[model samples]
Target: MREISLDRLRTLVAIADHGSFAEAARVLNLAPPTVSLHIADLEERVGGLLLSRTRGRVQPSAIGETLIERARRLLADAEQALEDVERQVQGLAGRVRLGASTGVIAQLIPQALETLSQEHAGIDVQVAVLTSQQTLQKLADGSLDIGVIALPQSPVKGLKIKPWRRDPVMAFLPARWACPDIISPAWLAAQPLILNDNSTRLSRQVGEWFATEGPQPTPRIQLNYNDAIKSLVAAGYGATVLPHEASTPAPESRIVMRPLQPSLWRELGIAHRAGEVERSTRHVLEVLWELEAL
Candidate 1:
């Protein structure tokens, strides 16, 4: 069977509304004979006569009414499909997949998403909390559209990295502890430590900092989440080191934030596929960059 034409369906609906072939042709801007031809073709294909003339007025047969109702719904769906595609083409609507560390997601993504919601309501940024290594790997594999990752990374093939922000890595100590003006590695190492898991770049960076001036300390416990590490510190269980963004909430009363004596910093970078990103992803990237604009 030949595929049904949407144009013929449209013509049928117009004729049903106006109750005259002449008026449908006028609204559709077609010759009256073309309107007749459309119905004749539809009727032949469906194997049914579809219209009746009574008292010099046109009305639909039982089959015509059923076809017209379905035709109206089909026409509405097709119009919506076209509009949806057009919105995506205009970068007004689409979905973008993004990956970042739990800390970054907590500190940064919420504000970015809020701003994006205001500016591009049709764009959605799906976030995954992943380690820096995992974020980079997914970006390379095309599983993710963007990544917020730790810096000093070895270059990966087919990925572009740009500095996003640098934040102070502060020691979050139990307020009960007798702490100095600045926290040195020796001072921090001597205390119980709650550090990020060994799998993380943060763990490696903190290790190198301790090795510089004193014995490298082993953490009492290691966990991936920054908030969990802070909770340990707040409970006076152990001291921890984590990046402190201005937007991050101030330490709780039980926790005291102290700068590292050597001034350690956590640098972050934005990463994406090297070239030809989709416009929807690009729109999301613009909002992400606006978070710090660096």
Candidate 2:
């Protein structure tokens, strides 16, 4: 059997991702002809055409799609292997890829990272803001070393989960609105509401909260970013429900945050692949756990 080259596999992936040979060449810093040659070499070795070009757009063929999926896993594993070897040889000096939701990234990860940096300057940290579902997918595929995600995540094989923190969901209203110190779900639902969209788990949870109280007013607007929702709320457009961590007031803000009467909370937790862990990854996790303790 003929061996497939990693370089060729990479070229195939770049072309599939970027949608054109020229675009992939630009991203990979290879000549257009060189990119073409790599694909040609791969197709010959695999005995099948890898890509189909149509009307200036390039797409992966059926065989190409299969190869590309496997290639991504291969590349991620190769990169992790290199990082693991480096950590073994040089102590705690390598990259740790961490994934989390926007709220955690905004409120928690930075503080934890600051402490990690002070203690282990040699370790490099990379953070990606992703939904809990996205974070779990990446962790399963070995693209992420650790993920901080909302709790109640569906069981995923090969993942070890642990609690991180819990944040209360608060109602954010215009400061001028006459509201009690503790707001009720019915009151919040009656008011013009700006809500997290259905794309997020928080939105579903919020929807369920409202459902338990019976039929409620529809949201005036739906958005994914907490800051954007806050901006609209500050303008008196509508109220919103957000994690307390993301309810911080800006200097020029006119938003008032209040806890719910029933007190809903979002639970957060960390997940990593089950079994033996890398030293650098474990060190980063220790730092995060310590920060949580404080």
Candidate 3:
């Protein structure tokens, strides 16, 4: 079967966009007869009438509509292919897909990305909010380039894991409510607690902290988002154990954050597939490393 010409496809799209073959020819810098012939060739190849002309305006027929949609995709793909080639030749523009947990995304990723943008304006970073386990799985599956995740994860074959940062877990309470200077697990467990759900590694750590003192206290609410948990705490609904970064003070905020007595900390790390890294991924890693040093 004969393949459709991109030029002819472009002509069809132009005519549809401008609502007339003459207008399309003007925009495309092609003669009106040339544009008409291009459409004729496309229709013959497609084995259907591709357009309907009324007065001076033109509209696509049903088959034309289908081919027009496909044609747009083909054109877009062609353009993207060209752009990718150009970016490769330029040696600085590329896309990197990075995965991390919600807390990392909120607290650290933005600053890292800000540094990345300053250093490499042409590089594009795409972020996915995923659990550490999910991030590891994606990295192994080649879906993600880099992942910022909670460390001390169960060993995964062929992954490069390096410690990133440590953040202290703090007890959050309403500022107006009476609370001790430093919160103990027993004290925290006795309150109406809004805890991180079991899906997060932090939740498991918190659970273990509670388990050390016999029976675990059930939470009044289990939530994943720190911001949402803080909102509830600020409203005097209940208290929560979350990262210290989550408790960043807002002006005249209703919430107060107190350190845990036997300070519990969450360890985060970066993971990537164990192999030769691509230039863009390496660039991102370099930026992250520099940020880590600072």
Candidate 4:
């Protein structure tokens, strides 16, 4: 019996993820032939074909599927072992890159980062601001260690999503807009508005809610930047809608956030590729989970 090498298993996982030798090679920082040779070696050692190749794409056969399942676990365990060793030597020293939707990054990430930094000064954190869709893609590509997103009821395969927190959508009214403290959708529509475009799940929730209320005019301004939308509303460019996190006061007297007479909110969660959890990432996730408890 041949002992499978971590290098070979890693190649298998990458090929399975990317669906092509060329792409997997790119991820592995190897020449395409090198990846092919490794997979061939792995297949020969296993004594069973592990993948089915079509025109250009590759997929796991039944045996390949079995191998992949085990491979992910093996790789995870191996990675964890490396992390544990490093922890002993360096004391939780490592870096993790995270992708976060615009809402959470803008509203909550700073505070959370400060908290993490206080506890684990050795763990370096890098965050990229991305839309939920982009975040999911980055996670799939292994470019991001974790993603914070708003997930739908149905889930994606090969990914693990954990609910982090609930965020409500609230109306941002001009500081001096003489409207009710909490306005109805109809009342909100009566004013000129700049809305966060329908590119995000939270924005779509607001759009659908408005659609259900009856016919309404399109927004005067369609914007993507959360802070810009808030600024516009404060400047009286128009009223805007934002998640409850954004609805919080800006500490300046110029903007006012009021709950909608009928309130709406979006649920947010942290997502990672399904498999062995990295020790460093697991520790960070524990911190987020604690935030939920708080």
Candidate 5:
């Protein structure tokens, strides 16, 4: 601020453009005395004359002309910076960082982003594929604005978690199998399964569902990727259980998506910082809620 304050710079530019200190004062809504003080302060700081009187009118001195040109650019940039911030505050423009699992990111998030693009074209959404634990950690650290995480999550400080979707954990079986209208934990336990890795919450939920029926079933192969699991099921390698997001397309040929009997659910929650959320993030949260399953 000591080098050259924006206020004094603005005063110099105004006086030079109007060619009259009184006229500049009137236009700037500053008193004539305040305008005169601003010019004196600027000249003292610059160590030179900034104004000259020629032919009974005021004009910029040689040094003043150079300073004024640079000042105009600075003022324009400052004004534009303010405008950009204002747009963000109003939720008309901003970049929102969102974190979600690979499954949700592949299937559901794109729908929300597509609507966001059409509605708030200036607002950009940056998505990251992360596990629920990773998502919660990112939200706590302020590196992320939103997180679509699996439910039954442990509480984290400085974070707000809300239930977003409760999708039925459907059994994706090979079409060649003698598939029933609704799959049962007992029947699925007997079949070759391509289940999620044991580390995931979905795997735990699926295990618990089968544990209730009888002994927990083992998987032929455990994977973390839903698309890969479905692809294997399509190849008749094994059956897999996955959450069916609302409005998603049907499964590929040779793969049958059937709801599990006993109605197991894969619940998801949205997480964000607990306080003072940015307007752009709030707008994105609203758009995400629009995708919630009934």
Candidate 6:
């Protein structure tokens, strides 16, 4: 049998993903007839049917299913090899996919990306906003090159986990509500609360604190974005808690942050798949450690 062509493999993958020859043609910028012809050619080369077409939908045959799995790996390895070559020639010139939870994306990631861009212009960094759970899933699937996640206990298999920094959680209070000095649990309890969304690691920590400090603390509002929560606090709607770096007071000083008596902190770390490490991923991790130090 003749070796199957890369074009044929790509068309097969595209059809499998789109579930229709017309849709695959649109994706690959080919005529629908051309796409059908490619698949026919591929099937003849392999001496088996690859797809079963009904009226509107398409399903891969058993042989097609097995070949699809192999095709995906081939495509992935091909892309990685290209990236590896670029890395060798250009220091760190390739796509690096990174994810971070919502709050960290606001302050931490922007600063880190700026520093990395300045030092290594060749590296192409793409960031996705993910919850801690979603970040873990993507890392496990090799969809992400690295992630800045809240610390995890046992590292994912074939992945390197490194502690990056500890962020002190602080109260965001309206200027009118800002206490003169340190905020005790009682003081925090006194204000109307704008709490973090329940899924967040910071939210879980804050919930535990609330449970210990004052059970059933009433909430005036809830928000997901760090900036939106700060905006509400500044408007005197209610107070919210987040990491210090996640927010800051206005120059004229309408909002302020005060340390809680018991104090709260969250750990942030970098996770990357274990193997021949990608240059862009290493550059990102190094910048994170530098930021943590300062």
Task: Give each model a TM-score.
Answer: 0.86, 0.67, 0.70, 0.67, 0.87, 0.68
Worst lDDT window (10 residues) for model 6? 244-253
Give all candidates' CA lDDT scores.
0.90, 0.85, 0.86, 0.80, 0.90, 0.81
Give the C-alpha miss distance for residue 109 in model 6, angstroms: 1.0
Per-residue CA lDDT of model 2 for 31-52, tens digit only, reads 9999999999998988998999
Ranking by TM-score: 5, 1, 3, 6, 4, 2
- Model 3 regions lying over 4 Å from their true place: 1-83, 86-91, 246-252
Locate the minimum summed-lDDT window of 10 residues in model 5. Answer: 285-294
How does model 3 score by TM-score?
Answer: 0.70
Model 1 TM-score relative to the real fold: 0.86
Model 3's alpha-carbon lDDT is 0.86
lDDT of model 2, residue 232: 91
Instruction: State how far residue 240 of model 1 sits from its true place (Å).
Output: 0.9
Q: Residues 1-294, candidate 3, lDDT per residue (tens digit)?
A: 998999999999998998999899999999999999999999889889999988868999999999999999999999999988787556477889999877778767887888888878888999998999899999999999999989798778999999876777878898988899998888888889898889999999998888776568999989787778888998999988877654234413788888887889988888988888877788899888765633
What are the per-residue Cα lDDT tens digits for candidate 5 across 1-294? 568889989999998888899999999999999999999999998899999999877999999998999999999999999999999999999999999988999888889989888888889899998889988888889899999999988889899999998887899999999988988889899999999897789988888899878998888999888999899999999999999876888898899988888998888999999989888998899899998853
Model 1, clash count?
0
| Global lDDT of model 1 | 0.90
Model 2 misplaced stretches (Cα beyond 4 Å): 1-91, 246-253
Clashes of 4: 0
Tens digits of per-residue lDDT for model 6, 1-294: 478877888999999999999999999999988998999998898899999987778989999999999999998899989877977555567778889877888877788888888998778888898987788789889899888888754667887788888878888788886374777666677778999778777778887877776775777877678888888888889887888763333322778887876888888888888887766677777787778754
Task: Judge candidate 6 against the unseen true structure and give its global Cα lDDT, from 0 to 1.
Answer: 0.81
* Candidate 1 residue lDDT tens string, 1-294: 697899999999999899899999999999999999999999999999888897887888999999999999999999999998888788899888999999998888998899889999999789999988999999998899999999989999999999998899999999999999799998899999999877888888899999888877888998888888888899999999999888767988999999998888899999999988888888888987887743
Residue pairs whose backbone atoms clash in candidate 2: none
Q: Which should have the higher TM-score, number 2 or number 3?
A: 3
